[model samples]
Target: MSQEIQNISPIKQRILQFIAELGRSKREFYSLTGISRGTLESKTGITEDTLTKLFTAFPDLSPIWVFTGKGEKLQSQQNETSPLFTVNENIEDKLLNIIAQKDSEIKALAEEIGKLKQEIIQLKELLLK
Candidate 1:
């Protein structure tokens, strides 16, 4: 609702609105959007890559509304009933969930790797002593 947000591109404003609707903080917005925290905070306008990521992550969101603010915030109810749309939505949700799980796994692995590296350094120091 700030003037800065209002002055930015419509897409960015819509993104902000979407995040607000979800009742998420900036940190959670970054997590949900899979956008880097620094980039989200620093960029005044949304990039094509970020937009693509946003749409891909939330298929139920209507791009028309996000880009032009002319349609419903969500996809039309007619599309929701279609078998193909439902299947695509299901696939996207599953994919996003899988990506989130993988990210957590990757973070845990990175921490373990760092610990192992430190232990190896300590062991090497002891051996030389």
Candidate 2:
């Protein structure tokens, strides 16, 4: 209910919210939903194509809620199943992924710095008589 979420169309907001709930990468969402990265960004409401793709990927989700802003967000589960991923697990997984990427970036930067330092030493030696 922040200003940003309130500004966009309701359906788009729900889709984005669902994406965060899924704890999956945008790349994965695009692959599964068959919608491109900017599809939600540009669209205000659900289209037939988007609805079909969304439902196909997420059968548990409530299309009525996503499309019309009516009813529960999820389809009622007769079997009383757990969510696809626990909220804590989703957050933990995202944090871990971020840490891994940052670690890799730091390593690459360290290697580059070492190379630059060595080049500086070599240049200094060459300039010294």
Candidate 3:
């Protein structure tokens, strides 16, 4: 929001404080959100409106906890008692899908190679006849 932050809106101030409390930097937030500098600037400037927009855009974000500083850091309530943050479960699913596709491709290539080898052997025998 505001460069000095003194001129920042309430919502922007809370967001800034949340980032600080989370031990995260602006660059890290930028990478996660993929929002442009101009959009972020404009959004932060309109703190009240931006809070709703941001929460709507990032449902997984814990806006109340982030702003009020009273609850968990994460948006979604997690059941796991693990202290460390982990990668999203979807990542594992995506990796498994890719491995399966690659395995199928490998099997098809092996079959084609086997057919080519048989053809080469047959041609060699015909020529030697």
The best candidate by lDDT is 2
lDDT of 3 by residue, 1-129 (tens): 356566655556666665577687767765655544444434345545545655665677676665665666575674557523246647777678778879999999999999999999999999999
Can you write out model 2's per-residue Cα lDDT over 31-98, one digit (the tens) per residue?
88888677777636657888789889999898778878777788873344654344666777877777
Query: Which stretch of 10 consecutive residues in model 3 shows the poorest summed lDDT?
Result: 35-44
- Candidate 1: tens digits of C-alpha lDDT, residues 7-82: 6676777777888898888788788778878554444666888887788888988888888887688885425433
Best by TM-score: 1
Worst 10 residues of 1 by lDDT: 77-86
Candidate lDDT scores, in order, read: 0.77, 0.80, 0.64
Better of 2 and 3 by lDDT: 2
Candidate 2 accuracy as lDDT: 0.80
Ranking by TM-score: 1, 2, 3
Segments in model 1 whose C-alpha atoms lie over 4 Å from true places: 38-44, 76-129
Where does candidate 2 clash, by residue pair? none
